[model samples]
Target: MPAGKGEKQPYFHCKKLNSMMKNPKPYFLLCAALIVVSFPTWSLSKTATHLDLVKLKNGTVLEGHIVSQTARSLNLENVGGMISILRESIDRVITAEPGESAMFLGAQLLERKKFARAEFFLKIAAEYPAWRTESNASLQKLNTIKEQLEEQRREKEKSDIEKLIRRKGVEAGISELERRHSAEDDYWGSVRGRLHLLMARERLDHYDLKMAEQHLTLAEKYGVTKEQWESVRNEIVAMRRKSLLYGEDKLASRAFQSRKRPDKTAAGGGLLALAGEAKKKGEKVPPLEWLELVDRYAGENDVDPLLIWALIDTESSWRSQVVSPKGAQGLMQLMPLTAKDLEVDNPFDPEENIRGGIRYLRFLLKMFKDTDTALAAYYVGPGRVERYNGIPPAGREYVQKVRTREAALNKRFGLSPQGRTLSKS
Candidate 1:
């Protein structure tokens, strides 16, 4: 298509004067360059360039002009070149009238606080000399906003962690801390370092020398200065000497007992209670063959294992071969479609089902950013949750049941919502 009205004409046009090249191309190029130099900023504001978008099913999106189309394929032309795309591969297409500047569109989207889309447009604008400075400035501002949002999210997580610690005790805090601070990701290392130091001090105060030393070592690795924790380390050494001299005292043994007692058959209060009550009624509780798989994938995906446990219990009652009335299968009860999407060939296999189900849970958690809503999505479907902007009415009971089970598991394991008994002291 020719340039829009009031826009500069292309320096080269085909199908004219026996070839449209009767005039020298270099002369036309010079003329085009002069026109570009003389182009006014005010004229750019008047002409807001529009582009077409072809979004593919595999998440590749092409931004360009659809130059031509046939029944099975369409051709797109962009700065890159003309390319053909099969209709079968296309997910959706969006077309806009050709006329706006990328900078203008970026600024408009930025005003709407649509950061991701705005960043795309701003990046395009930044490539041109005329718009580079302004576009780069906008990009910087967008980055600042993203950083601020991240900081706010971290703050909210900290607040939630504090509340969980208050309600469930230090073990809960440790579990949450481990869930959020992985050694591979050091963004939260310093914060974790300080917390570990604090926990180590508490352990020392309680005369739990082993856990205290463990926390101290973790704190050092996480960025705590040796000097900052030297005194704590010294105390740990002194306590160790005392223990060696006197042998494992009753108080020390009691501290160990305090941590170990929660793992006892009778004291395993959470999900075990469910199994116990079922046994009391002569109802058979399914074997928990997938528990180890759940732990593995949950850690890999940074999901709360207790949540996965609750979901599995609610989905299939720990029966590896169970099939739901709706045709969902296995311990995690994966539907055939979901199983396929997760690349699980055998959904009834305990390991496959648990891995796929936990991964799905992780995806939902990231998409919805709330456990309850994500659980609702997990039960009903993400589309329904998104349509309702939260947990749908049909999924309320399912979410509630899973949450209740999660809390019970928390009690049973004596850990936080994210299950793990690191540092007993």
Candidate 2:
């Protein structure tokens, strides 16, 4: 029907369609049909100022002027003329608002594969209804890809660790693993367990049963398998049995029992008081089974008990049965000849070793008249100290370790360098 004066024309009616339908020539009906199917294009002003950005669910962004809209669809006029878009396929609609233009910037960054910056802007733009769905979907997809890449990197690192262990040694593998995981606070439990197992095995090879057992406990806590735990445990038990069978544990146990005890008054009440106060303050006194034995012999030989404790800790880490590769045995690492000259019947005996080591250190202290020089003489020999007229180059590190350990022990026991108990400030 044609509209009368002041009456509005229906949106579907067009003059071009009417002309073609009325002519009725060959192809006239077909031409009219084409016009009817595509007659809803509004003659909107083709300018950037009047455009809306339509973002599709599939991440396609279309810039055009919205010609008309119905309840379920909208008509857009771009360079391609009229496109009818279903409302369900559209993710968002950005009108020609000034700030809404930045929503498309995230899409551009995403196209360039700059995911971090893309996510940042996308998150900001997602605050509005115009860009929420697309932004969140993009973030989810980006996170998935990032997680995949991180997994690949971790897998590659694990492969490298295996290669390093095979080519070099377990120590090399442990160094590499520790270097990588040092920055991570919460690493995967399985990987941490593997690291602990490696350390346990290494310590076992070195015959450090105490450290090996400690690492094994940590390994099991982290997630090591029962089989691996059993294997390390058996090794530790075997090593301990070997030490006992050689009379190493027996002689040490007997010597410790036979050692003389120091009188609290003779050794100075301050030292005993410091230990008691440290215990009351919930501090761990340095772990030495023969601490009073050390004090008794050190007092007899005119040596500092703390210095003796430091030497024992550094030389053998408190393992009474440990023997060095150089044939130095016991907590003090006394060589066979040194043990003989000092009249130590069994170098593995803790009491004899401690007394002999304290006597030898006292002689060195009197001869060298310097604590560091005496420590250096103890590590390398009095002959080496005499040849160099001071601590040798190799013995400097030994001297430093002993002195550092002595200082730590002093702090631990609340003692000062002048043999007086230090008061807490």
Candidate 3:
């Protein structure tokens, strides 16, 4: 401490050396503390910026920043540069920021063509200002996809309705189409025009020239082609001339003669005259009392009214009161137990009997899904039909009789076979 300025320090520095040697434990402790504190910091610095984790289907995990995405792929940035991955191959993704996660997930789903799900995520992402622009663009794409899907669905429904028309006949098919028209807004004009055209054809087939012309006019108004209109018009004219020459005068004479007496003939004769008179007055014929009830109920149930009429004519000749040896009665020849099952109090009552019989026929038709099989079931009993896997041999004559009468009635009344026959063959 008292050494002169010119004197050099001690060469050995023995006191300092002796103090260091005695405090070697302190130096070791300080070094240990520094290492422990710095290890966690280094680890945190390496992992803290790795905010996202992507797990691939191939069992590889990637820690990176999601950069961008397209409909089919995703781009990620990491220490090893940028990498692309297919959205379909990614097993899962994890992110700390919810908004950013939604934005990225939305892009991935969009690439996968999951438009609805993508739209949901993009809407959430749109709430974040940083992702708003890209999110909105994705939403626009989703809107376009939605429109395409809706258009496809509408086209499929239209095709299905058209097929129904082919299978169910014009009136029933047009009714179904109209119901759909009321419920939908797209392609309504086209549907209406198609319905009108079908109705025109049905009317023409039935020789209702005036009604056919009215429907054709409506079809034209609704955008039917001129060629179609002209063709249908020509057909109607030809049919009308043929009907007037060969059918109408004879039908009128028969109807007038039949109506001259009610007691000698079935009530149907008078009812036919009333229908003719209503047609002359341009009025719809009211529902007839007995025989015509078959038509009304069969039409409502989508069964062929002609078939019902043929059955009634064969069973009771339109008499309302006829009993078989087996205890079958009424116009439909319903057994008492069957009438009670159908909740009919009077089997002799025409309306009740027709209703019960048609309801049973509807059930059979549904069960068989074929008119021939259903008629067979009605004739021979469903159990026998099922046992034989077809019409029983004993029931074949009955079926032939019904079919023959049905054909005769169709020819006599000028009714079309469009929706009435299950099989053309």
Per-residue lDDT for 1-425 in model 1, tens only?
87799996665665564244566687689889988887875344343456678999999998765655656666654543335677778999887643224666677777787665576567767776656767788899999998999999989988988999999998998887885664224222134465467667767756866677666656665567758777776676555545544555765776656542222222234344444455577876444334545655665667766677778879878878888876779888777866865668999778888888877776667656788987887777665666677777999999889989878766655665422511112
In model 1, residue pairs whose N, Cα or C atoms come closer than 3 Å (at least 3 residues apart or on different chains), thus clashing, are 48-99, 48-100, 48-101, 49-99, 49-100, 49-101, 50-99, 50-100, 270-412
Q: What is the TM-score of each candidate against the true structure?
A: 0.35, 0.35, 0.33
Error of 2 at 317 (Å): 1.2
The number of clashing residue pairs in each candidate reads 9, 0, 1
Q: Candidate 3's C-alpha lDDT?
A: 0.65
| Model 3, TM vs. native | 0.33
User: Mind giving the per-residue lDDT tens digits that candidate 2 earns over 268-370?
Assistant: 3456466656677887664434675677687666577778878988999877799997678998998775676455899888899888888767767766789
After superposition, the stretches of candidate 1 with alpha carbons farther than 4 Å from their true spots are 1-288, 418-425
The per-model lDDT (C-alpha) reads 0.67, 0.66, 0.65
Residue-by-residue lDDT tens digits, candidate 3, 1-425: 65689886654558776565667688778889999988765543211122468899999998655655555666654433335666778999886463565666677767787554466567877887656767787789888887998899989977887898788877877787776665223213243454456667755645566667666656675566768876886676555545444565664455456432212222234334534555577874323455456655665567776788788777777767889876788888887755764557898988999998887777677666788877777666665676677777977888888889889766655546543421211
Error of 2 at 391 (Å): 0.7
Error of 3 at 402 (Å): 0.4
